[model samples]
Target: MIPFRFLHAADLHLDSRFAGLAHLPAAVRSYLRESTFAALGRLICLAIKENVDFVVISGDIYDVSDASLQGQLRFQEALKELGEQGIPVFLIHGNHDPLDGPRLVAEMPEHVTVFGGDAPGYATAHRRRDGQEVAIVSGISYPTAKVTANTAVTFSRKPGSELFHIALLHGNVDGDLQHETYSPCSRKDLIGQGFDYWALGHIHKRSILYEKPYIVYPGNIQGRSVKETGPKGCYVVDVRENGEAALQFHELDIVRWQVTELSIDGMEHEAQWVEAVERRIEDIREADPHLMTVVRFRLTGRGNVHRLLAEKGAAADLLSELQRREALRAERKEYPGLVWTEGFAVESGLAVDRSRLLQEDSFLGEMLRLAEKGEGEGSREELEDIISSAIAPLMENRELRRLLSQVSEEEKLDWLRGAAELGITLLSGLEGAGEAEGGFRDKPDGGRYDED
Candidate 1:
């Protein structure tokens, strides 16, 4: 039996536009761009430190269809470092990095073996220490961006070989929703192929669908958005003598994306709100001190701060001031190693006084009544259209739009409360009676009337 270790990594997304990252401070932006290569360098260092036999990069090394020469050279230099240390590297092209275009890996070091986008291809190598031959790999690359049929059907375990077999594939498994069915295959298909390990890629979230043949995704080395939060990186697998494997995740991501929600309901002033936000930030920093975070905050609840948040430009200004103060604090060694707060999303505003609105028989009240009636008697589509139109102005407003986009659970509950109040007030007004002065009053005919 041949015992060996290997590093598996995928979805580098190198040189991709840091779209939302522009809001970050200049130093953070610089770190983000450079962090992709730095993570790859770290992966190489890990491989060298662990004395792995070879490194397998499943796919998507670069983000652009036409990759930059500088990016290619940077990757080449890192791979060269591994080659100089007598370690071999193998790779396959994924959907993002197809093979029909200019080959980026063409001038790579001799130790690098890239499987081209052609018919079934495989590689055989021997372990130098034990002189034991091993069927190291088999794979197919994406010829073009779209591949509808299964690419794995073409590959089979090497015949008449006593060595342990492994297959490297860059395709979506049957259940993945985010990826196209490019090079699609199934767990059953891979397990029946007699391969010992299947290194898979194209999905940015790491997963292990099957363990019998060891099918796995190493996920992306770095997260690009809030959706891809938490620790992001590759995996290190140790293949034992009896064909068993042990997998360990290694986080190589330098920049982290975090979403945090802070409630300002009980807090009386903006200073308290800032302190609350700072406390939350400090908590996250202590939990993951090395992380460079892109945090999104949702400040909510009914309080004096809520009125301030309702005013135009006030919420944004307050958030900016808070971030500036925190940044300054970080600079003064009060909170050392703290990265910039990328951006602030206010998911808070003044809780609507629906009862007050209904009492006045205003246009908003009429709209709410119409919405409720439509919801009860109208078709689903009609009801949806009515509600959407009723909320159109709020959605169109830039500040409200931003707030609603990242609304927290408490904000949602507040909205529900407002809705309930509106419903009750509308019901009361329908009981017709003469107007009175402030609050709701009962008329002689057993009806309730709202006072103006």
Candidate 2:
């Protein structure tokens, strides 16, 4: 009936280069580069503050490609600090930091217990104040980078073990659209294993897969790209004397990647458009005066702004004005700064009504139908092929390749939607539907790259 606490975290991705964003400002890049380590520092600080019995790191401690000594040394120092505080660290190596990973060059501190790569490792932590056994955490590290098996099914409660049981692992349970199926297990497989808690890694977004005997994914400590938005961090868990468990999340991401949609339906002039966008930018900077923020935007809804946004070079001009404004504010020290737009997409539908036009068998109606056919025609793959062929010329750029590497399908779809909007605008102009608005949106999918 002993009560205890532990911090569960995963996917440190230490020293990982912020992908899909090779063109951010130097100051922003510098902050992003150190964000993963900072997240670790925050985790360590939280551990000390909570006086947790131990800490559990599911996996992916560091990106294997970034074999920087700074990351290694920083990791060593942080664990050493926890050791000095008499707190134990239990961790497993995920695919990104497999036992054979090239980036893992440093030794762990004495207080850290890393589950072996060959098999699942076991450890028991004793409460610092009372010296009573709080729990036994079982973990399995990846022997190599790609392990595909139900690793969870391989575990069983220790022989007559009389303590709380926790399991640590790095794998895909069932399947994930956002990630590869590595070391795959099943939810039922994990739950039936009789482990009191499962601290998982690999997947970057947090999810509570089960209750009672808790199965949780703590997600990554820091978001590396636009695909990873919102809060990112670790979980603090308390196992009460009656074995009732509770979890609370702490934010560790120093830079938050976010996307917001703005409606430009009411604006009639260019000045109004600029004012509306500048106001939103102000709101973003005010969101957190303390931390840096990278944002992407989706300008949605049916409005004249959609036609303007479809014009060439319009998106860049908009972003430039925003950047200039940011610089002015920062120079005058009028605002506590640290915000920039990574990219944006214009998904606005055409402002003109086509319901009556579609009643006639006209070219405009056919164009509109074809443009939206992907929504129902099962022609998405076909359209993707056409789009890919058209944009292949731009893909030759190395920077473009790297930028798209971390982009998710969901984000990519935003660009495709913008393309459809542009098509609608072009067709409207051709049909003598008056002057099209010059407003434009930019997407990372070759929409508009920031030149500044």
Candidate 3:
């Protein structure tokens, strides 16, 4: 029986510049681009400190098509240090670094073995102190960028052997959505091969598909964008003599990206809105001081501020003020850094008068009645067409159309409710003849252009 530990990592995307990082503060942009290599250094240090048996990099060690010679040399230098300590490194080339052209494997340390894209291969390493031998790893690289068939079937575990077996693959599992369908293989397909563990890559989010045989994705070593938020890192797996494996996640990302939403529905004053936004930023920074957040705020519900936000130059002025406050806070060291707020996507507007419309004996009223009939035993499509035709003229009206466009989906629904309420009030107040022409009366609450 033998005990060993290994670090499973994927999607390093090293030496990659995030073009979007330019939107962030200069300090933050520097951190994101430089931190990736720094995190890789930490990973190597951790492996040395933990005295792990080996390191398995599933794929995408570098982002460049042909990685810089300096970058290649630096990587080889790190591998050389591990080789000096008698630790072996197993690696596979992912889509980002396909095997067919401009190879760097030749420059790496002798202890590092890279699997070629042509065929599946494995390397054997021995536990010196105990004299127990284990199959260190097996994998195949991407011959070209796209692999549509099963790469797992080409790999088979050693025959009639009880030694620990692990397969490193840089491809998609049966149902991963974030990545293209590359080197597609099923969980059953891998299990049938009798491997003890499957190291997967291509998906940036970390996940554990099965624990019994330990199929896992260590996620991306760093968060590249808003989409890749939260803690990004690798997994350290400890395989015991009894075949029971224990896994622990280690934070390998130096910089992170996060999304937070702020609601400005009830905020009536600019000061109050600023205060609320400041509070939210503080909360986010406190949660993760190293986080570079991209906020997408939604201002919903009915409020006077909605009208102000709707005015020309008002929204732009608010964004500028918010940016100034964020900068000040960051300068004072109150918050880590506000990358940039995508914007306060507002969804607020004036209430509509619906009661008056319902009381009218016009075509609009008849359409509203049909709409209110609800999803009954009728053709929903036909009823929707009628309702659409009825509302088309109003929707096409320039002022109403502009207001509707300014508000959010939910706020538009609220405006519809207001129209219904007003229609009801006018209907109750009108006599027979007056009610007939009520639908076209130029909006009693000071016309459609009124401040309300």
The lDDT, on a scale of 0 to 1, for candidate 2 is 0.75
Give the local distance difference test score of model 3: 0.68
Predicted model with the maximum lDDT: 2
Better of 1 and 2 by TM-score: 2
Backbone clash tally for model 1? 0
Off by over 4 Å in 3: 21-26, 103-106, 128-131, 290-304, 307-452
lDDT of 3 by residue, 39-154 (tens): 78878888888788889999888775586666566677778888887778999988887776485557566788888888888787566346468555888998887788798899
**Tens digit of per-residue lDDT, candidate 1, span 254-346:** 777766667666666777876777777778778777766656665544455655554434556655765676556444544334644544444
lDDT tens digits, residue span 430-451, model 2: 4322343334333344443221
Q: Compare the candidates by TM-score and give the number of the best one.
A: 2
Residue range with the least summed lDDT across 10 consecutive positions in model 2: 443-452
Regarding TM-score, does 1 or 3 come out ahead?
1
Alpha carbon RMSD to native, model 2: 7.1
C-alpha TM-scores of all predictions: 0.73, 0.80, 0.72
Please report, in order, the local distance difference test score of every candidate based on alpha carbons.
0.68, 0.75, 0.68
